[model samples]
Target: MVNYRYLGNSGLKITELTYGNWITHASQVENAQATACVRAALDVGITSFDTADVYANTAAEEVLGEALKGERRESLEIFTKVFWPTGPGGANDMGLSRKHIMESIHGSLRRLQTDYVDLYQAHRYDYDTPLEETMSAFADLVHSGKVHYIGVSEWTADQIRAGAALAKELRIPFVSSQPQYSMLWRVIEDEVVPASREVGVSQIVWSPVAQGILTGKYKPGQAPPAGSRATDEKSGAKFIERFMREDILTRVQHLRPIADELGLTMAQLAIAWVLQNSNVAAAIIGASRPEQVRDNAKASGVEIPAELMTRIDEVLGDVVERDPARTVEAGPRSR
Candidate 1:
């Protein structure tokens, strides 16, 4: 069985290693392919799935909901995010406006074929909508049983504080934050992780594989692998140029020996490294096949020794990926 951790301040505990859908959902891949990926994830003890409303133009949820059309729903925690344009019709179509949250939650339920989401999230910060409006709407969802818990994705330190303060006054459950965090992405480590730790919020990390960069599938002086997401037009491969610096590549290259010594894949070692951090409530993984999820699941029980941690820091250096620049100056995480 997968190891579980309580998500932030919420009593709800989920497997520390969870499944997430990005390109895997939506129209980017076939529904049959998506179903296979999810089944593989579940078979390996993944009990949570994180998806966004706008992923694959909202069709991803419909697909997932359909795939979960049996007893499969009983044992799983389904999470879906909002805050993007669902389509081209209304003024209330995007962001965290009260009208959008109110409408979108119902829409998501319809697509998900569920009564309530285990966790409903703000997919990203909404500068246009006031935090009060967003919090009040979320509180209504929690009160009315439309959502079990609440979370925010990709929010900065100030945004989390503002939302948490409002949720506290409203007595609504604000439990977790979803951000791009991984062995290659330490941007959150500098400040965001510390802020979440302080506010008693749990972190459900997305892209735990660093978009497959840290898996050793991509390397310096190597051609992009055939049929890899990095080769796709819509994939987020363009941003990796900054991460592909020679010094960083050298550091990544140094990790191969460690994985080899342990008789594990680089991806497994990369995942094991993240789970060693106590602040991480869960690491959300994306998989296109059963093998990928199975491979990731194996990493759950692999313990990283203190010497390996020291070696990692020394070799990987200070470079880590994030939605923004790794420019934040803050103290290291207190474990």
Candidate 2:
């Protein structure tokens, strides 16, 4: 069974290895495969699921809802996000304005076949909308019992501080911070982690395997293998290009011995590394296949030694992206 942790200061406990359907559901695989993966996650005791309305234009949430049908809703935590363009791409179709946030939540609940989601997140910091307006909308959802908790994704530390302050005044549970965190991407550590800690927010990290880079499947100085994310031009390839350099690949290969010494697969090692952080309430793992879920679930309780963690940092060296500015840079400048 997977270990569980409290999300921020909230009483709600989530599986440390939560299932996320980002690219795998609806877009990358068929419905059957996606459901099989979800079943595999349940088999491994993953009770927390993360999704976004923008994923496959809201199809991912529907797939997740269908897959999770018949399970006791009380025993699970279903999370979804707003703040991205879904449905028609109208001027008001996206962002964290009251109109979009309110409309988006209703559509998400309808598609998800759930009356309410456990955690409703702002998928990104909407620069165009007033922070007070966005937070007010979330507060209304919480008060109406449509959303249980609130979270944000990819917001800067200052942004989190501002939101958390507003959430405090509104008296809503601002519990989790969703960010891209892995061995390769350390952008959140410098600022976001500290701010979130102060504001009583824990991390629910995405891409703990760094888009499969830490899995040691992509060899240095060679073309990517067939059917890999790197080969998929439409979806995953662009997100992974930044880590495809020979030098980074070579450094990634160096972590193989550390994983071997730990008696874990590279993917397990990568996931475990993120869970080692106390602030990380859960690390979201997405899978295209059932076996991938089973394999990643093993990372739940594994603990890497301090010396090995140091060695991992040494091995990866300066290749790690520790810039705090990257957090803001990664978010949208408009909308």
Candidate 3:
């Protein structure tokens, strides 16, 4: 079973390994497969789920809702995000503006088949909308019982500081952050982690496997295995492209002995690596098959030793992306 961690300083405790449906829920797999994956997560004691309204253009939430239908709602932590175009790309369809946030929550609730989500997150910081407007709208949702807690995904350190200050003023729970974190990607370490630690916010990291590159299945100089995320152009191939270079793959192969020593698969080693961060409350894992969920869930309780941790850094040395500026560069400049 997966262990639990408190999100930030809050009373709520979530599974250390959260099951997120970013690309696999409705877009990459059939409904039956998606539901089975959710079941596998449940069977392994994962109670936290993460999703976004813009995933599969909103069908993902519906599928997740149906899959978790008979489970006890209070026993689960359901998180969803706003700030992307869902339902047609209209001018009013995206961003963290008051109008979009307000409308998007209602649609998310209706599709998720729940009265309130455990955590409602801003998918990204909206460059065009005033932060006050966005936080105030989120405050309204908390007041109305539509959302239990608030979070943001991929916001910069300064942005998190500003938002945490406003959240304190509004008296709403601003408790979590979701960022792309993995062995190969350490963009959040320098700035975001420190800022979040100061503000009582914990990280719910995504892509701990670097979109499956850390799994050690993608060879150094060969075509990606058929049906892999690297080949699935519609779902996540573009995201994995950054790490598909021969040099990166060759360096990744160096970590196999480390995994062998630990008796963990490369994927498990990668996921365990991120959870070693004290600020990370949870690492979100997505899966297309039920067994993938089961396999990755084993990473939850494994503790990588200090020397091996150091050696991992030594092995992946220059391949790691540790720049804090990449956080800003990765986010959108305009709504």
Candidate 4:
């Protein structure tokens, strides 16, 4: 069964495993397939669903809305993000600016077919917008009842600290931090995790399987499988290239014995490793098939022995990317 965790210090409870539609829902798969995957997630007891306004040019949100049309709205936590271009070409089309945020929330609500989103996040820090302006805008959204809690994704420790300070002054709940965290990507542990813990923000991590590399599907010195993400022409292949090296693939092969010993699949071991961190409130998984959701949801309540966890670190040493400075930021839009 999927267990729940308090989002940071907030009373809001979310499933430890969150089903997200990022690059899949409206882009790579059919509506029926996407709906099937969502149904599979729900059937497996996942109550938290995540999406973004910019995914597939805003089609992902609409697809998710249709999938959850008849469910009790209060029984689920629906999270969406703003801060990439989601509208027609214009200076005000993106970022965390009050104008864009205000405009984006309503567009999100309409597309989602919901009266309010449970957790609204800044998809990325808006370097072009002042922190106060962005915080004040989010504060207004919370006060207006359109959004319940606020969070940020892929932000640096410094960025999270600055935002948390303003969120405190505004008396708004900054309850979650979403980062790319996994057994291979330890970037969040050094800085983001510490900062978020200090500021009362739990992590809702993404790419917990390192884009499926940790699944041990891609073998070293072999061409990617026919339908695997590494073979996708659009975006998957590119997004997963960082961990596609032979060194990484070879080291990943060594995990099979550990997984076999624990009676868990490679994917489940990966997700369970991330959940071992107390600060990780949830780990987001994206699936294109209903079976994938069923398989991943089993990772929710798993616990890895400490000795095995340490062995995983030793086996994956050096290949792991732990630099806190690797946190990314987007450049201002060039008009």
Candidate 5:
């Protein structure tokens, strides 16, 4: 069985491996498949779920609502986020302004068929709106019992500090922050990770496999596999370039031998590597198929040897660019 960790300072405890609607939403995976995958995820001890309002045009929540008909719902920690445009040609369309935030939560609750969300995030830093306004609004949600705890996604470490400080002053409970983190992307290490650690805000990481590039499935000069997320229209044409750059590709390829020696799949190794960080409260994985969930779950307790870490670091150093100690904007997995 997997172990659970206290998420930030909040009362909620969650399994290290969480599932979310980042990819396998109702818009893509069929209803039966989504149900089965979610079931498999829960069976293996995943208690936290991450989703966004814009995922699948609101269909993801609808599907999860249906999936959580009765008994199963009580055992889950449902987390969904706001802060993106959902409609157009109307006055009230998007953003984290007080008006939009208030309305968006109700809409999310209605779609999710739940009274309260375990975690509600800002999705992105809404610099246009006052931080106090946004933080206070989330405080209101907690006050009214519509949300259990508030969180922010992809905001700069400074932004998180401002929001967290505001919540502290207002006496609102803020628990976690979400960002893109994995073997390849370590931008959070610079400031976001440290800021979160200092403020008692645990990190919930997305793209734990570096948008699947770290899985070693894509090779040099090879065509993308059919029906893969890399081929999706939403992904920019440069998706392959940014991740599978010659140097990055070489490093990703090198992991294959390490994975083979450990008798684990590349996907499992990628996930296990990220979970090594104790500050990582949960690593949200997106899977389109039930087997994919099972495959990822197999690495829950697999340990990596210290010698392997040396080789792993050697391989990572060759491909990883930018300073882990430098603070910068998050990657595509932001919210």
Candidate 6:
């Protein structure tokens, strides 16, 4: 079983590890395999299910909804996001504008087969839309009972604080932020985490395994294993390429002994390392196979020693990205 943590200051408890279907269910695998993976996650005690309407152009939500059919809805926390263009469209197609946010939530509900979502997230900060308009729209969702809490992903420290301040004024439950956080990606630590803690927002981190780079499967100066994420053109292969450098791969290999010493898989060690931050409410893991879910769930409550943490820093050294200014902004609506 997995441990549950309260999301930020909210009373709602979410599993420490979240099962997210980003590039897996609708992009890389068929519905049958996706269903099996969802079941495997449930069997391993994952209650938080996350997805986005843009994932596979809305097919992912549909598959997840069908797979979760007949389960007690109140027993799980269903999370989804908006801000990405979901289909072929016009000017109002994407971003966190009031019109898009209002329309997208209903479509997401229909696709997910749920009346309400536990936590609805803004997938990215909308530079085109005014923050007040976006926050007010989210406030409307919360007040309407369609959304329990509000969250944002890949938002900067200033963005988080601004949203939290507005949320307080609006009396909306702005509880969480989702950012790509891992041992290899420490950008959140220097800014986002601290700002979030100050504003009562907890992090639900994604890419905690660093796009499977921390698994130690890819060797230095060698080809990535066949069918791995790095070679999967449709599934974040380009994003995974940044960590595939020989120096980075060599440093990753050094983590194996640390994993061995702790009797944990490299993936588990990486996941647990992220959970060591008290401000993190959960670490999100994506999987194309059921066994991957089983392996990652074990990291939920495992605590890593401080000495090993220092060793990880020494090993990873200069390769780690710790820029406080790092923030992934949304692209222009046209793109």
Model 5 lDDT, residue 233, Cα = 69
lDDT of 3 by residue, 56-145 (tens): 999999999999999999999999999989967889998999999999999999999999999999999998999999999999999999
- Give each model a TM-score: 0.92, 0.99, 0.99, 0.98, 0.93, 0.98
Q: Which ten residues in a row have the lowest lDDT in candidate 5?
A: 326-335
Off by over 4 Å in 2: none
Return whichever of 3 and 6 wins on TM-score.
Answer: 3
Instruction: Name the lDDT of candidate 6.
Output: 0.92
How much is the lDDT of residue 265 in candidate 6?
98
> Compared with the true structure, what per-residue lDDT tens digits does model 6 show for residues 125-225?
88888999999999999999999999999898999999999999999999999999899999888889889999999999999999999999999988889
Candidate 3, residue 99: the lDDT equals 92
What lDDT does candidate 2 reach at residue 168? Answer: 97
For candidate 4, give the lDDT.
0.93
Error of 2 at 186 (Å): 0.2
**Number of the predicted model whose lDDT against the real structure is largest:** 2
Q: Which stretches of candidate 1 lie over 4 Å from their true place?
A: 239-241, 321-335
Q: Judge candidate 4 at residue 90 and give its lDDT.
A: 91
Clashing pairs in 2: none
Two-way TM-score contest, 2 vs 6, winner: 2
RMSD of 5: 2.6
Write model 4 residue lDDT over 40-137, tens digit each, in one string: 99999999999999999999999999999999999999999999998787989988889999999998999999999999999988878898999999
- Please give, for residues 1-335, the per-residue lDDT of candidate 1 as tens digits: 67888988778989888887777776456888888888887888888888888988788889888877784566889999988888785777888889899889998999989999999998888777778999999999999998999998878877788899999999988889888777888767767778888888888888776777787777777777887767776755664555656666667878898888788798888888888878888888887777888888988877887888888877776764543434222211110
Give the range where candidate 3 is weakest over 10 consecutive residues by summed lDDT: 326-335
Off by over 4 Å in 3: none
Could you tell which candidate, 4 or 5, scores higher by TM-score?
A: 4
Q: Native-vs-model 5 lDDT?
A: 0.80
